[model samples]
Target: MLAIGMDLGGTAVKAVVIDHYGNVLKTMSKPLGQHATSIDEWNWKGVVKSVAADLMEEFKGRITAMGMSAPGICNEENTAIYSMPGRFYGLEKFIWTEYLDHETWILNDAHSALMAEAQFGAAKGYKHAILLTLGTGVGGGIIIDGKLLQGRNMMAGHLGHITVDADNPELDIFKIPGSIEDHIGNATIEKRTYNRYEATHELEAAYRAGDPVATYVWLSSVRKLSIAMCSLINALSPEVFVLGGGIAQAGDSLMKPLAAFMEIHEWRPRGEGVPVVVAHHGEHAGAIGAAAFAIRQSTK
Candidate 1:
């Protein structure tokens, strides 16, 4: 049987068809048709309806399930989104089942990325894993004993918003102070650098060119990020860490120092520092993972 997976991103919606073996067969995409900061619920519903109809018509009886990866805290029962509205603000308590006619699942986008990587990418073959996607915001997920850690309210792994610096004044919506995302998200990085670079890579390039200002700024953020990782390593001790998203695309420019700091700093009660690797799937990870989640849940 096939499964339909959708990654409902702020800028666009990516959909994919995957077979039982975790292979993505066909893919579809469209603009999310909403503002970056907010969404019109009625317009979003219409967009989803049209997209679901297209997938259903093409797959028909062969499709066994449909799943969506969305931003926010998904309810434990998978019936609706309850909080943390990054883009789909009006979707709180919005029932997702009404959008389709199949076995369905709704997942936090970061969790979906973890599912995809655990099954087919960086975290494959590991029982305990951690994934951090660093982009406009920092996203995270935890895998324990081969299962995604979805807690009572399904907000258990919202790692990015974790407060590491209580005195940090960068407010995330006017209240949160010193959260990880506010300190190191790509958006924050650009702002912190005074818009000197448009993307993280530019900043990395400047740092590599031995630019003193770039070196200081980049290292400072990396140090904060390493501190956060050390906490997770000490607490969870995952077997591996997969770093995805635009910022991670900087590759060793990002990993080398982080690894160096982590090796010296991360708790080693179990042994040495865990392997931190780049993600195998990129933008399509959410859709692929959404399919994998449904496929796994169906069998269980």
Candidate 2:
């Protein structure tokens, strides 16, 4: 069966058509523009309408279902937003499902990423796993016994918002001080390194060149990430930890320090031999996961 997947991000909305086995057939993307202030800002209904029209026009009679992944807290019914940080606002009551006029499943963007990893990527065959996306903000999802953990109200997997420091909290526009996002996310890394350099690529190159300032900034971010990972490992003992997103592209630079820090801090049994791997699908993971969800929902 063919399904449509939509990944709504801060700056872009990506859509894809995929088959039941996770193979992408076609893809499309559109810039969300600056109007996408918060999770509610994008004429969400309009976007969905446009995407549906596009897919229907392209595939004619092939597509069977649709699924969406957004960067926010999605309600248990998979219809509306509970809370969103970067893009879209005042959307607590807005329901995207109603606008679609088709069977649709909405999930937190991180949950979709984790689902992608669990179903087809690094976490495949693992019953319990944590997928972390180190991007503009740190996003995470937890999977247990092959099921996504959507707590009461479907707000269970906001690992990025977990408090790291009770006393000296790192503040961000979201106002959630001490949030894990504030510690190791892309913005944090950028701000920490900007005084020494202006561009992200430059900072990365500096890190590669062994610049002390860049190393300090990068290592500091990785250390915070390691702490968060260790906490998750202790709590869930996931079989695999899959890391993805723009920052994850740092590859060994990001994973090595994180692994070393986890080694020193994590508890014995949970930490031992735990595999930390990079995401295989890259940015398309959300789309793939959404497609997978759509296919599963159709079968059900």
Candidate 3:
């Protein structure tokens, strides 16, 4: 049988149809309708339903299960997002099963990305791993002892919001001081570089051009990320670390400096440093992961 995985992003909804083996058979994406001036004006609920209907019609009897991934903390029931302020209008606590007329599983987007990696991507075959998605903001997840760590409040793997510099005045979305996101996330690139760079790519380009300011800013961010990874390594002790999202696309520009810094900061007991790699599923990670989650849950 096949499974449906849907990723509800800020601008679009991405869905994938995959077989039991996790091979993708079809993919769909649609914009999230007109922009809403306020939460009450949002139209994403309809958009999501429409997308699901279209996919369901196409796959028909072949589809067996479905899962959704979105930007928020999933409730313990895995039925809906319990907390996601300032976006997606009616998403919070909206029951997917009742609306979609099917048994649907849901998870946080970051957790879904890590799930994709653990099931079929970078962290496949590893019992313990961590994933960090560095984009406009940093998102994270962890797998421990072969299971995703949802914690008591399902907020276990918010690695980016963890404080790396407690004395710094800046706080992240979670109001944590000097969070790793504040240091390296794309949202703070301009502020961190004194308005000289608008995005991480621009900074990386300037750094490649031997610009002193760009070099300083980029390396500093990478260093903070390394420190964060080191802290996670010590705490969770995952066998591997996977990096994904837009920022990880910097290739050697990001990985090289991160490697150099990790060499200095990461703790290596018995000379066994944790392996760090880029995600294998790329942009489709959330969709693939949602499908994987659905397939497994349905079988169980």
The Cα local distance difference test for each model comes to: 0.83, 0.79, 0.90
Cα TM-score per model? 0.92, 0.89, 0.97
Query: Which stretches in model 1 have alpha-carbon errors above 4 Å?
Result: 34-42, 84-86, 170-176
Q: Listing every candidate in turn, what is its Cα RMSD in Å to the true structure after a full C-alpha superposition?
A: 2.3, 2.7, 1.2
Quote the lDDT for 61 in model 3.
Answer: 78
lDDT of 2 by residue, 248-285 (tens): 88877777778789889888753366788998887778
What local lDDT does model 1 show for residue 88? Answer: 67
Better of 2 and 3 by TM-score: 3
Superior by lDDT: candidate 2 or candidate 3: 3
Using lDDT as the measure, which candidate wins?
3
In order of listing, the candidates' clash counts read: 0, 7, 0
lDDT of 1 by residue, 189-254 (tens): 767788787777788899999998889889878888888888887889898988888888887788
Clashing pairs for model 1 are none
Cα-lDDT of candidate 2? 0.79
Q: Estimate, for each residue in 1-300, the C-alpha lDDT of model 3 and write its tens digit.
A: 898899999889999988877788998888886778665577787778898899899888778899999988889988899988888777889899899998899989999999899988899999999999999999999998999999987888888999889998766789999999999898998899999999999999999999999999899889999999999999899999999999999999999999999999988878878999999987778988988888888888
